[model samples]
Target: MEETSITAEPGKQEIVISRVFDAPPDLVFKACTDPELISRWWAPESITTTVEKMDTRPGGMWRVTQRDAEGNEYAFHGVYHEVTPERIVDTFEYEAMPGHVLLETETIEDLGGGRTKMTDHLIFQSVEDRDGMLQSGMEEEMTGPMERLAELLQSLKQAAPAR
Candidate 1:
């Protein structure tokens, strides 16, 4: 299992999430940015996720929808502001809460020996918005999907021929 860490300060308008994957940086980044691979592990047990649209270049757009067990659909859309082998910067907003947007930057660090670390920083519109997310079971919601991501990466690596 991957170790995941999340920190959110009471007054700071930022959320930091980090996790180490047992895969190389390039493969980890591919799993994150590839729509097909992403759709497989981006949702928790009770929710089904689908990539509605994905464009992985700077200024490109993406939209994904998650449907809960109760059939409630939640959509999120974002525009990529920057994209590099090691990092990505994007805007993120839930469709229901239009203006409560945030800037998210994801960095993948090569940790040597086939290990990769991903750090995600989310700068929210305000402290209140950040706090609200923290209080809304965000950590619990993320943990499962992140674990799923690790599993998916492990499987992917296993399937690849040894290099």
Candidate 2:
């Protein structure tokens, strides 16, 4: 699997992360939208997540809370703008910091040969907001969870009997 990230507008504050996973697109998509799977790998190892509500359809809303090791809780809420088997677009807001919103789009494509490519594009309201998120350690926060997902996928494959 290959991964790459780029900041489309360093000044305007847009972040994009692309990753190729050794899994089918449908499986990858399910890992993203399924609450159970989400909770299993949505945050870093030191954090625990609780899904307050999840409605995964266009115009539906999802709310989740993350509790850090220090017992501090952060809440995230989002309204789905578009929802399809292969793509999802949403508006996200951090309840802890109201008025700071982000528009996020996730696309999953089948790369064939049991591989999938997933791209996540995040747009902040302003460059400041984007910088603030980065400064707050967003990238580090995501790394562990993503690694966990990879491990989970590996385990799934290992447990499956041959053909």
Candidate 3:
């Protein structure tokens, strides 16, 4: 149960988050790029997720919507500008804050011994926008989903047949 490591430099328009999971790169990558697996662990416990669309290829598009317990829906959409076995590059935009787009790059590093490391770099349009997101409780918002992802990975590993 290691914590996700995060780095946010002052005056920079980016945030980086890193974590290791007890799974191989292929399985970890599938958990991220697959819509069904994403829906299982991409939202906080208080929210239910719906995968509107996902196309994990260069120029492909993806969208996800989440509904809170209060019945309020939140949506996010992005385009896949780059995709590979170990890295993904995409643009992310929250519907409520239109025009405030951010570029996200996620990298998966094989850590050996049945483990993989994931790092997400989120680049905002400006430092102000990045600060705004941080102020909006971005870390808190991500903590649960990340923990859920770890749990889901463990479950998936258990379900697989012996190699």
Candidate 4:
């Protein structure tokens, strides 16, 4: 299991999460941008997630909704500012919070020999918002999805036929 590194500097409005995967950059990028692949690992095992819309190009919109056992749905939608195999920039807004939007930049760094490092940088609108997110158990909640992503990537690599 890979440990996720989360850096949250006091008084700053940003949180950066980083993790390394045993898969190449292309594979990691595909898993993130593909709606089908995203649904498989975007949420925890106990939560059911559906990718309502996913447009990978710039100025596109994406939305995903997650339903829990009690029928509560949590929806998140974002607009893509930039999209590339190596980097993605988007605006993320949780539906419940209305106007609390954050900009996210995810970079997939190829480390050679079939390994890649994914770094997600999130900049909140304010320091209070950033601190609120940290206090909301966001760090713990993120681990599940990341672990699932790693597992899904491994499965994808094994399923791919020899080149």
lDDT of 1 by residue, 25-143 (tens): 98888998999999999888788899999999999999999999888999999999998889999999999989999999999999999999999999999999998888889999888
lDDT tens digits, residue span 1-163, model 2: 4544544556976888677778777678778888887888888888898888889998999999999888999999999999887899999899989999999999999889888887889999999999899889878765666677776666666766754
- Rank list by lDDT: 4, 3, 1, 2
* Cα-based TM-score, every candidate: 0.97, 0.91, 0.98, 0.98
Please report the TM-score between candidate 1 and the true structure: 0.97
lDDT values of the candidates? 0.92, 0.83, 0.93, 0.95
List the lowest-lDDT window of 10 residues for candidate 2: 1-10
lDDT by residue (1-163, candidate 3, tens digit) is 7688878999999999989998889888999999999999998888999999999999999999999999999999999999888999999999999999999999999999989999999999999999999999989888888899999999999999876
Best by lDDT: 4
All models, RMSD in angstroms: 0.8, 1.8, 0.7, 0.8
Any runs in candidate 1 off by more than 4 Å, and if so which? Answer: none
Whichever of 2 and 3 has more lDDT, that candidate is 3
Q: Where does model 3 exceed 4 Å of error?
A: none
Cα-based RMSD of candidate 3: 0.7
Candidate 4 lDDT: 0.95
Per-residue lDDT of candidate 4, residues 52-78 (tens digit):
999999999999999999999999999
lDDT of 2 at 105: 97
> Candidate 2, 153: how far from true, in Å?
2.5
Clashing pairs for predicted structure model 1, backbone only: none
**Candidates, ranked, TM-score:** 3, 4, 1, 2
Name the TM-score of candidate 4: 0.98
